[model samples]
Target: MSADKLYILDTNVLLHDPNCLYEFKEQDVAIPMTVLEELDSIKDRKQSVAQEARHVIRAIDNILSAATSPTQITKGVQILVPGTGDDSKLGKLSVFPDHELTSRQGFLPIEKNNDNRIINCALHLQSSDPHRDIILVTKDINMRLKAMGAGLQKVEDYRKDQLVSDVELLPSGHYHIEGNFWEKVSDVKSYQEGPNTYHKVSPDLLPEAYVNQYVFDDSNDFAARVESIDHEKTVLRDLGFGHLMQQSCWGISPINIYQAFAMQSVLDEDIDLCVLNGAAGSGKTLVALACALEMVIEEGRYNKIIVTRSTPPVAEDIGFLPGTEEEKMTPWLSSIHDNLEAMHENDDRPQSSVKYAIEKANIQFKSLNFIRGRSIQDAVVLIDEAQNLTPQQLKTILTRCGKGSKMICLGNLAQIDSNYLTPLTSGLTYIVERFKGFDGAANIHFEGIFRSRLAEYAEEHL
Candidate 1:
């Protein structure tokens, strides 16, 4: 398979998440001796990955030990590096605020600072394996730059977070129609022509998306509709929920998949920007993704699926974060992956080889701090962590959208992670308020949390 799939491990990759090695199940995996040395140095450090790496290394060693003298270990990713080949020997080096490499830094009292030695290890490997895909993988960007400058192929940090937006992991965007969709309810109760039906809307009917447009069609459907769009900002008209199969992230939870079908019924350009707001675990991401999958690979409403999140990091976070951006983003990006796994589990049908059965191009996991001034088009953009965004930030993200693109911002306004900010002042709130009158926008909120009884109770009561 010319997948060009030779991989090298970096120290920070293991530290970020120990299970990262599992993501490449059957691929040829490599770990520079420097990375191993780095891991050895940190094995006793009090961090989650350090603990995990100890176990991981033990497990891998066991596998290596079990391998027969005759049988080829034809499968599974292995952590390996060159030893007899490189002319270099491990050197001890110490790094301090004032430690400059130009000063002939040595691994003196310190055996080897985690960064430089592993880098030297990577460089040595590159020197030995010149062309057979010798790549340096590290979470440290500067280290990556150093490796590249040293003439080694340094790649971006590939966290098991699987941050890449694959065809299957992409998210969908939606629009809401709340403000004028039902404002002056007239007895004019015809799908077409007002007040001319003469049959009169029964007291039982309320406004809703009937035949793909909002009208006082009936009331029984609004709760489900509101509930569906509330979390996913999509309509559920197909599952016999009420309306037709309107699109966007309406409902895809175990309780709401029916609503998702209905929302798919209403999927159309008329309602482009869909809002799926929910308390954590309500399956907002799942449903948004379902709709996005539908439009992208199934219905062709989009060319690609782009999922972006803006953590906004609150001008003042509680304290300093350890490690780097990858470390910082792990906690937040997990929400997206959690939703994706749920979607994949729910999706039992056969899928395409390249694209996720219903989705494609999850795209890049962008930090809200970046993405400014970059224009996005021809895709369904999902802005997660929207609660952290201010009205201005939200506006900026939305303006980055180009022709034929739709965006959905999903966040818990009440969960407002940003400092000194409230639900009413969140960027999501601003977007809802600003786009209230736009026919292309839809604002929906999901109140029920589908994660766990304890979590829901905690969110509700304590």
Candidate 2:
């Protein structure tokens, strides 16, 4: 609908995007007291959700603190977007207290149930403001169902940062030319430089080409990647991945074009940010690690490899585990160890070992909790399981990169573990869509499973 409707935001929405309040510009936002309690309970933790909880709480506090009087909150407090020119369209922020909402004619309360309390709060708002359109915004599927069942006319998931509606709609970073592509490119100027061939085509000819996007013409066995895009022309370079596919990195060679593209992205120093999306057995992490090792150990382009991942638990929170930070992160970083051991197999040196190579290459495992407020320079930073991170968390980690540093984000969107994230809203998808056209960024979607035949079968069937 329009931007004048009233929105009741669930806690999960705020955790998914702390800045969601501003997204519903000029729309009245009502925060349930139960949501505040939930945020307060989780704000002291080390997870990204806790950080988001704190940020949202502070933002709401700031908005309310600007109120002229305490009674203004009851009527409604104007939430201003400092630079926006429309004061007449400024949104209103209100709080719905648990005490103010009780078991009514059609609503029943479940004692000590936060979800039930939230739904009840929405029901109260819906009944009170029958003239104004009210909607409940949430990321939880069951919460939306319960809200719908509670007679709320409108309920939906937050979609502010979601560029694509589904994973199937995500950008493929490549386009296939079906016609006589060679004839289409006959008028284009071409030249060869070093290992790459360059072709300058009119921007109109390559409508779907973005910076660093691969383009293929299967009819003539021609493939080229977009090198640069400007208003006047688009320059494409022949991709070397076809030739490099057979070459071994550490001990692993790319089994498919997807893996080769992924390697090209991770090893290219010109590309500052690389996003890899693949399934469990697609060799996303393994290829990333192998490229990181090659860049750090053989090429000496970066000083070290810094790896990190979200530590989202499978079930309930088990509280804090006792150990040093590295020791505590070992459980979450088991995949890194497995990949490193595979890399060690190619080392023919008599004294070479996984421990020795890791030490020699200066590979460091970092916990995502302590990644903020520090600059990571001259390193190959690999963020694994990025699907579990919120877009806000991914932004924080990427901002930490300094000069001479490369950041590679690898994840399978379908395997996200975060309760607040979906395949379309995962941080990996965020990066892919956000940086799709940027010259310093590249994206690779792995389609092949290279681990083993059994692993491929399991990935496909199970």
Candidate 3:
């Protein structure tokens, strides 16, 4: 089909995904001059988004370099599909110089505010080009509302990285059968392999099953992990429900069945990545920390435990803090300490035991800023508050994992703090959906709140 629409991207969209320019298929894309200026101002900051801003600038430059003259550049430049020749069908990319326009004409005034100028640019394009559809794409909700209010033809949130329409549709990492799970299975070949039991059933038995996903029944009689699936059959590794509930790590046991699944994944050496999603007080941090300690301190499977998380104010406030990087991060990582304290509360000397565990595990608290270029190996990396991260930021961290390393990502989608991220676009959700089919990864969305009655009540009502 011929390209009939023009997409004007905002600054936040580029920062959210640097490679979004190529996702529009055959639609023409444009960047307002104000958006470029915003990216220029933010490219030098210490925040993770600054790196993405620089990438977007470089991508735009690479595409515009194909143009021979300034007129052709401002008008449009062909965006060829990567690895394709010049004859390949492609879309056009251009820079809209909204700063040169003097006519406001019923649009938002081009004041000192950059958002107003960008909205006015889209409004101008809508009126100037009556033949094509003009759409304003932004991650900012207020900016979209202003563009629509300014009489623009169309305004939409940047959804190129959004995999699901609603957060409710996300996989909970486990499927619960209404009654006895075995009763639903008609054709099944059960066998034993070494110490593990495996069941080969028809694909129609669990059509929605994915590798590494857990399945159980309400009767509490059966629990199994999907090991492999193909056109012929689906293989399941039977996990006795009672045994899973009885599993303990670092003197900590699962409080609920969902946590049992999470503990199993986190403690398993075969799984390289484990993603834990839940509400506040759902014991995500506690379970992850406990398993990390078990693997690092008691079992000696890993050399150390590395804990890190992204804070909203980390860009500006982290540099001003006193002492070392660990001390500065202690405030944001206080939740980790809280979990440690809770785990050692019953000990004879709680404070001393917590300090000893910290020292014994060789735990290091690092900032996400310094984790870009280092290769992490022989350690258990725990990333808390992963929902606040963008997909680009998460990719940077995930790629740093070297051989003999495991990553545990913990996040509460409802508590995302980034202004540029929603539940559908959060890095946690992206990884869960992207890695669901991978055999070496496991995802668990915890159930219930175990912190306290007051906390549980607040989580539901307040």
Best by TM-score: 3
- Compared with the true structure, what per-residue lDDT tens digits does model 1 show for residues 35-149? 6566687777543234545855664464455345323232332333223322132111111121222214332222445555555554444555565554556656676776666
After superposition, the stretches of candidate 2 with alpha carbons farther than 4 Å from their true spots are 1-4, 82-89, 104-106, 177-183, 192-196, 219-221, 230-232, 240-242, 314-319, 346-352
lDDT of 3 by residue, 1-462 (tens): 436999999999998899998888878899999899999999999776788899999999989999999998778888977666452556889999989865446666676888988888888888888888999999999888877777887999988788889999999999888989888888899999988999999989899999999999987769999999999999999999999999999899999999999999998889999999999999999999999999998899999999999898987788999999999889999999999999999999999999999999998999998898989999999999999999889999999999999999999999989888999999999999989889899999999998999999999998
Can you tell me which runs of candidate 1 are displaced by over 4 Å? 1-266, 312-331, 346-359
- Which of 1 and 3 is ahead in lDDT? 3
TM-score of each: 0.46, 0.92, 0.97
- The deviation in Å at residue 437 for candidate 2 is 0.6
Error of 2 at 5 (Å): 1.3
Better of 2 and 3 by TM-score: 3
lDDT of 2 by residue, 123-222 (tens): 8777877888889999999989888977889999999999887788788776778865667754688898886789888888887778888776654356
Which stretches in model 3 have alpha-carbon errors above 4 Å?
83-89, 103-106
Q: Each prediction's Cα lDDT score?
A: 0.52, 0.81, 0.91
Q: Name the lDDT value of residue 421 in candidate 1.
A: 40
